[model samples]
Target: MLGLRFIGQGFAGLFGLIGLFPVMAQAADSRLQRMETSDAGRGWEAVGRLDVDGEGFCTGALIAPDLVLTAAHCLYDARSGVRIQPKTIEFLAGWRNGRASAYRTVTRAVVHPDYIFDGEVSTDRVRRDIALLQLQRPIRNTTVIPFQTDNRPRKGADVGVVSYAHDRSEAPSIQELCSVMARQEGVLIMSCDVDFGSSGAPVFSFSGGKPRIVSVVSAKAEVDGKRVSLGADLAKELQILRAQLTSTRIGSRMPEGVGRVQVGGARSSGGAKFVRPGG
Candidate 1:
């Protein structure tokens, strides 16, 4: 139920009054490429849309054959603050024009221990806003190769993002050129174009020849008169989620008569909207 409204300069001006500074002096290129054809989206098969009980969606990435990385907020019911059953979640890899390169159900999900879904926008919430999903089956297809993950990128480093926003939900879009504006308190502020349904989208760093995930989109905010996206550093959070997943066993069946919950309410400063990735 998360939604976005572009307020343009007025939104930026409000942030300026608060003495916050724009991360990037000039706007970074965040032009999106519609991955409507296989040829156009050849190497992006690992990124996918996570469908939550047929009600909402969030962006996610495959980090291992049977493991997916996303935002922890995606796993909670925004209205009741209850955790959604994992069996109801599904991953549609390389989804494009009603088709998918691979499909798999979620067996279990582990959220960061420090993540709080209290509807507050803080460095703590943003920094710990990560989760890991264990897929029912491994995606070993040639086209759907999982991506590798690395530490957060340095400030001003060039980054990229692939996400499914409200306007462009049918097919995923890749912004090949974005910039990491700042790093603070284990959180990353980037000049990446993101909106509702883009939560949990993977932010990639191309330090090596191949693309590696560096952070996960948590929210969109106006920082010092500039529109920017907030992300969680994955290094420590990923390790915690992985350890939890390995040690715990998730139930196979879901509780009976679990209904879908709607999520939308008040907005915070900077016109910020708290999005629950797949909720």
Candidate 2:
């Protein structure tokens, strides 16, 4: 297990534990575009913000009509170091300007069996840092279609991300093109820009005509002095989480509280911190 590094200020700050830093200079083709209106983000209705108990939020995507995918750490309480109640979480699909295309409450959540809220950064943690949330009701809306996931992308492959950052929390931003810098262990280091409230955002690959989720944003890190975003290989982790959710009932055994706290910044209302790349 590789040790994690802590840096930055609180969630509201410019950069925090989860790595929400100033946008680094990138090619003109890779800038983030704010999805201010519904028409501006038509096909991305499945991606939305996961508001946890009205405290703070993280990015999440609907993988199934009733299943949402996000980072496991987002399910724990940053201050108390306990699992948050599933009922407290709400999925705001295509959330923009305080309105959402679809709304569903969480009935249960299950994290990867190997994930630990130990307040450390490691390949193991990042690789397995994923979770599945069962919604209170199935979102069978016509416009909000769930996304299918595929295998991880090869290094140097072009990828894209849609997320809600702290500065642009009201609306989601789309980075249509970024490159995967490297693949180590079960983690991917990519040049994709991210910030606070971007955790659990979906990384998409457009190998086919439509987009499929390839990874979930876990943290922002400085790899060899270069700013990069970290994510889990969803190919295997997503399968494991699905099995865990189906094999056992997560009703009574579910822990109560927000997820774990990362190093660097103070705890936010969501109990997680944002990391700044190259801070």
Candidate 3:
């Protein structure tokens, strides 16, 4: 239940409401297994590391050849409260050890129009904390296939996550099965193990017999002194972000306060603890 505190902090209000009962998954939950080898990392090449302006990184997944999905908060500077420049970000597909299966620079990006990056964590913010990035070119790598997304899983369903965090930034790790502890508003609280730089990591559902992304890690929360991961319910928010991306003209200027995730800088002082971008 540890969080990427360096990226941001978790909120406290919702803990009073979520059920502590362990929501079971179709498969037994397993500890995070690092995909350090090519064989261990196969089929998960689409889950790549989002290198933000070279300052830090977050976990992101490809949903289409040119489209990547992640958290909205990742588009801001955790230290300066500034929106990042899309051109400065790089999508390192299947980053393992020191190499990647594919590399692409980000051309344009968009966050949920309603997503506010004020740097505060809350159930409301987490619910809409989703964004999509457009790669400069489509990834034609045969091994790297984009994942289709589905509605968030029910409370009784099991889920999985693949991510890159500060301690294991060189490669991604996977928790094949975890419980979807509870659902409130649009946030899916789960028993997934995650840490800093894990933001924007995709939460997958395997009930359909194939993995389909159903959520994006927004923040991590603690309840009853035990930690749980929080994620965006992708169904509705992703729809809006897609439309925004479609209407966006290449090289067009986005209004300030919107988003572009860059993981740089951090507050040298205290604030509401939530996961910040670029863990």
- Report lDDT per candidate: 0.77, 0.78, 0.79
Candidate 1 per-residue lDDT over residues 1-279, each given as its tens digit: 111222321122121122124455346575878888889889999999888777777899999999999988887776666777888889999998889999999988788877777644557777898989999989989989999999889988999999986667778999998998777778787888887778899999998778999999987776544677878988888988888788876673234434332334322222123354323
Candidate 3 lDDT trough over 10 residues, lowest sum: 1-10
211-239 per-residue lDDT for model 2 (tens digits): 99999998876643466788999998888
Q: What is the C-alpha RMSD of each candidate to the true structure, in Å?
A: 6.0, 5.6, 4.8
User: Against the true structure, what is each candidate's TM-score?
Assistant: 0.85, 0.85, 0.86
**How many clashing pairs per prediction, in order?**
0, 18, 15
TM-score of 2: 0.85
Candidate 2 deviant stretches above 4 angstroms? 1-7, 10-29, 256-279
Q: Compute the lDDT of residue 206 as modeled in candidate 2.
A: 85
Q: Evaluate model 3: give its lDDT.
A: 0.79
**Residue-level error in angstroms, candidate 3, position 93:** 0.5
Model 1: lDDT to the true structure: 0.77
